[model samples]
Target: MPLLAYWVTYASLDRAQTDWYLFWRARFRAGEPLPTDLSYIFLHVYETLHGVGFNRPEAAFAHLQRLWRSYRVDHPQLDHHLVDWLADFIRYYDLDDEVTRAWLDEAWVHAHGDLAVHYWLERGGGGEVPEGVFQHLISYRPEQNKFYRDAEDKAALDTLLRRAVVLTDSFYRETTGESVFERLKTKATHTVERRAFSGAVFEGPDFQYTVATIRQYRQDGRLSKLLTQAVRHAENLARKQVGFRSLLRDVKLPANLAAYLDVHLAPALATLQPPSPVQTPPAPERPRVQLDLGRLATLQQESEQVRGRLLEETEPGEASTDLEPSISPAVPATPALPAAPLAAVHRPPLPAQVAEGELTEVDSIAEVLAGITDAARDLLRQLRNQGWEAPEGDLRLPPGVFTSTLVDEVNEAAQPRLGDVLLQQQDGRLVAVDDYRNELAFLLGTPEPAALTPPLDGPWGALAGLLSPLHLEVLAQLLQTDLTLGELEVFTTARHALGSAVLEDLNSHALDTVGDILVDPYGDPLTLEDAYRDDVRRVLHASGLVHPE
Candidate 1:
């Protein structure tokens, strides 16, 4: 029968009526060369078998394989169509196992590369295929295929890009002994194939994987985008290093690829110049008060004379007897008080009431004041006369002396002996803390002001007096809220003291006065005992060391 007649008869027959083997055998044996347009026959047969369902995939695949092997040589043009249909049959029947894959490749995988890739990808695109086959499959850029075009595939691409960066960074580190990624260690166990690229060979077990992945992107016309991203990533990795440009220059890539990276990375390199040193403005000059010493002496003499004249006019009889010297030689006259002595005043002799070996509290405070500079005494005197708070300008500071420094000097001297800051600067005014007002007045020889808060009596009062200023400040902060050792250190460190020592001192004093430790020294966050919290608070409040909440 004519080829056309047989083809028509085959199409007309149902599966039950047709003998696939005998029918094709007769045509093959006819010896009239197979027609170039025999793909219809292959398609018709594949459809017929597929319609029979995949209940017997092996039989169906074997039948298609037989037809392909039988006619593919005579009808070379039909080979592409037949192989495609057979691959589709194998895929549709889920026969894409090692057996069928070998069968399909032997049939035509070499001649039809795209179909081979499609077949492989349809099988989830994993496992080891022939290297040449893999190259051909990846060469087609399967990631752009509709089946692989999703976030998962994009992530795969990103993963490959990152591997490339790490490999490249590893290459630089190995060749130049410098790290581009700043990684101290690497998992690159594979020795570099020295001649693989132009400059340096990258490391890592994934080197072959990275090469294939990169080749796929390169074939997909995305190499530039990939390299640009890689260059930017490397730049970020090396941004903090002083040798970024050198690191980039040492990147082990082919000349052209390295040049491409350089072009993209040049703009960032230009901006990476070492940062300029910051310039600080100089402090402004202070105006020095140049005093006329002779004129000051004349003014002082005039002021004293005016003061004596006014006193005589107000009480002539008392003034006469007080000012006149005693006539009798046997009875010595009491020496008059000296004029306002700014320069040559001496510390008062220890009071007779103070025992020779022991320093009384008043004498100790006086000693603290006596150790301070004349400027500090003057500042204290002004604060005392002005109700313990006065503007900085009214304090009569000496030339080149600042009110803050003088106050610090006085507080430092007093803190060691008196155990508290005698003076503090607030709102540009020198002020004495209310708790120390009486002591400050007596130290400066000023009349004592009425106490703002009455003194704490009994053990609480004694404990308050015994506690150092740092201890009180720490206690005050704890009274508001319990403090950690770190928080307490902030208060003590400025005073060159330790928080633990302050607590120890406080507990020691509490033992002596309250007969029990007030603060729980072993607590994580130091806390006062519940029984003594109120009493401690009351003592601090009454002494004006700490105020009511």
Candidate 2:
């Protein structure tokens, strides 16, 4: 119809040529004999016949017969097309009769199928099929499962099939009170077995598929790319190791295909071998981070500023008195009558500060300390909530696993390793966010503190029951080995924190250990400073896990 329309509109032919083209087309459509004048029109009619033939074969057949009658003798080219179309019809559907036989005898042999024979069998209402030609009609093994490249994959498939059979057997026996295992086994063995390329079942290697079809099957959706690669590798292995050339001798395939597999495919598969076992991966190296003592020093300075502010707030009335002596001048008593102007004098209110909930921002020492405390606690809670536990005894974590509230400069400059303490900057002041000393001691690998006191029932009570975090850390280390005074000082930053005030606090908690350190063996008591440096170490070791060696 479209070709007819094109000629009518665009050909610009005379009225006679237009009528002649229309007459032939109309004659073909009307099932009338095509005029002898337009003999070339048979080819165009056959092309149209093929387009509409698959569903309406009877109408297509009428056109086919007419076309064949017109050109089958002289125009063998048109006969070739007619034979090919008939072959397709025979392959896909049931057809028979003298007309079918005539076309079947003229069919072309191709890679596809036995088109003529299949059509004859279907059209004759089915009969005994000849030995090898139409075996795919009964049951066909998909090219995907014909052969496996991987031995492991083949084994897995076999296991799945056996399990499926067992499950089906169990279901049938329970439901029907009869075991169908033997019957199903025989049926599966006969029907599911793959046919050899030559149509014999048990005459060739287990795999009978062409590499071309295998490649196509591997491109399918269910198989992953990795699986496809493995299959390809297995195919290569089987060709070399399984004696593919020797196996191909027993089977039948196209000469070209067999030659390609042996000459091209065999060499390719041999080169693509599995990896060697000797090469092992190296262990991963961890990143390093530097701790910033400068940040801690700045925090200490901010703490001192906060302390000064707190002292002034506590004695607000004395603030003016303290300044009065330095002023050396005072306001006269005459100012009492000029109170109205003094009251009217505009003193702009303090600039509004950023607020969060009920807590408004304040430029005071106490508020600064409070902010530090809140930030520290919030950070600690966050780390804990995110599964960062306070490990006992020398915690060594990966770099950046636990984050600190330090400024970007500090964080970026160094990668903080495990066992490093974290500090946060709050309101321009740095404060300890987590206690690393005891946490390190409590880590799984570190030594435990001497259980001097009775074991506590809870995590907090246990930590609080022991010596302070610093002392606990010292004890954990000392338990492993004794260290000289200089070595101990170098081992930790806590040595600087072990001043008289801290010693006194420790003495209050562990009175017996402190009392023993205060007195000398000669009955004279040592000074607090000397006692801390010398006697305290001895006394602590005697009381705890550490013993002088």
lDDT of 1 at 187: 26
Which regions of candidate 2 deviate over 4 angstroms?
A: 1-382, 385-466, 494-496, 499-505, 512-549
Q: Model 1 Cα displacement at 473 (Å)? A: 1.7
Candidate maximizing TM-score: 1
Residue-level lDDT tens digits of model 1 in 53-149: 3357786677566666666777664453455445555544456678786885575443222234334434543343432333432212323221122
Please provide the root mean square deviation of candidate 1 (C-alpha atoms, Å): 37.2
Predicted structure 2: lDDT: 0.35
Estimate TM-scores for all models: 0.24, 0.17
Error of 1 at 209 (Å): 77
Residues 76-182, candidate 2: write the lDDT tens digits. Answer: 54443454444444433345667777755444221122222233333441232222222212121112221333233444333332222233334445566654322
Clashing pairs for predicted structure model 1, backbone only: none
- RMSDs, each prediction? 37.2, 39.8
Q: What local lDDT score does residue 247 receive in model 1, on the 0 to 100 scale?
A: 22
